[model samples]
Target: MTLPVDPDLRPVSVATADGSGAHYWVWGDPAATTTVVAVHGFRGDHHGLLPIVVGLDDARVVTPDLPGFGVSAAFDSGPHDVDAYAAWLTTFCRQLHRTGDRLVVVGHSFGSVIGAAAVAGGLCPDALVLMNPIAAPALAGPRAVLSTIALGYYRAGARLPESLGNALLTNPVIVRALSEVMAHTADPALRSWIHDQHRRYFSSFADRRVVVEAFEASVSHDIGEYAARISVPTLLIAGDRDDIVPVAAVQRLAGELTDSRLLVLADVGHLIHYERAEPAAAAINEFLARRLGGSTSGRP
Candidate 1:
């Protein structure tokens, strides 16, 4: 089924640093010299990166599926921990980033958190842009607990025909949690596409053990301190109505970054780039133009 999303942009596979078979999409534009590498959210593929890809023009766009997500294969233990994900990404960039390419890393939600970790661990991009990044979490209520337990049961159920797995995805509370998690994207097109992907991707998770491990890692990992030490020009964008990551958390992240600017879209939810693409694009464009002007010539 074709859900709502732009069909124009496509990804090009790049060699993985650790020989992990990572794939990324590149929107090439000769007029634009800078290459903005986009990292997607948890359990999210590069398609979910459309809003961000469209948000920036006059620059080449690159969106990649990190390990244990999207087209990237799961490692032996999966990419369970935040540090491991960042380490893998740090290696990916070191191998793929061209010598003369001006680099900017844009990460959304879980991707943003991982991006911050990557920066602190020495990924060394010129700037870091985080959208609706997770600073803290809203506790999962009774319903959340029930849903997790139920998903646990379903995951352990008897084997069925592979094509018939969609039936297992039928818990309302689970659906609601997904709805809440995805509240970050305000655009219907973007939202629907994400929802559709959840239905599809959740059913086809590559390695269950690794995915669960990664999920546990994400829940336990917090990079507020590392975020604070960032010396690069950083931009944090938060949607006031976002349910996944609280605006307060986004603000806290902004406070941590030494050279950072924050934007709070009042009435806008997580997918502000899709719902209010122009202004969002303008914010990023203005920042990039100011920072990337007259380059120092040699930096990753």
Candidate 2:
């Protein structure tokens, strides 16, 4: 990915409060055209796509591990809804030294939906790059059913029996299924680190309190309807063979956004940035060059 601009960047704490626990990594020169805030997918940590962010030499990179992941694992809060995430983003952005108004949020999978919801609710960054984004309708099938059921179980366990939260979180079958979904990586260290993050899962402050509340708040989170509200350029990238997010969601997004572009690549997986790093980096660089007042001199 463009020779890995900041090849071995280190992670640092970025939150101003203990309750707001967040770890981040900054790549490239800070005085670039714009800063890219890369959000990781579900169960992923901050360093998940370091290579992808570092590849774009002309842009500054800022990545965070949301609560329940990475160094923010100890962050116990009210709920993990889009509003909370969006608020955290706003708070964090204001803290960036001399960041100066230009922002481009690039979210992957679950992060994309959350970012879209954030953008809709006025977290309006300059541009949105959704990679293998999870659209509302695509998550309306078995995934939704399972999510709703989990929330219900988490909620009910508080009143009736204390089985749901513990059982589901530690359930062998469910764990196996989740593990399978994360089986895309072959690196032992990376896989082990991610699996540990997943295994750190326990009952939240309340069973499914945060997730259930987030699910409700995120019910009508349609990125398309909000895409029109986004006052910025946008890009939607999808891998036809993504295991978690369907490519059709990207197609739906393309039809919804007024100033947006779509790029579909074959033989790539859900974690396109991690799997096909070079091409993904090229696409991102090319996009910024064409849309963000930069020249397409050396960009692919």
Per-residue lDDT tens digits of candidate 1, residues 1-300?
232245433445665655576777776464455778788766567776666566575677777777766667766543457888788778877666777777888887777778888999888998888777766632242234543654464444324443433343444456547655645655677567556555554433455555555555555555474775578998888888875566777777777778989988777676564455567667787778778774222223
Candidate 1: residue 259 Cα off by (Å): 0.7
Q: What is the C-alpha RMSD of each candidate to the true structure, in Å?
A: 4.9, 5.0
Model 2 steric clash total: 0
lDDT of each: 0.66, 0.64
Local error of candidate 2 at residue 110 (angstroms): 1.7
Q: Report the Cα lDDT for residue 67, model 2.
A: 62
- By TM-score, the best candidate is 1
Query: Candidate 2's residue-wise lDDT over 1-300, tens digit each?
Result: 233444334565567533666768777666565778888765455655765775665777888776655556433656676667766766666576344546778888767777776777777577788887765553374356655665565455434445655465446566556665744666777566545444543223233344445445444354665667666788888887775556776787787777888999777657676666667778887887778666422223
Tell me the lDDT of candidate 2: 0.64
TM per candidate comes to: 0.78, 0.74
Q: What number of clashing residue pairs does each candidate have, in the order they appear? A: 5, 0
Q: What would you estimate as the lDDT of candidate 1?
A: 0.66
Clashing pairs in model 1, backbone N/Cα/C closer than 3 A: 11-25, 184-270, 184-271, 185-271, 228-256
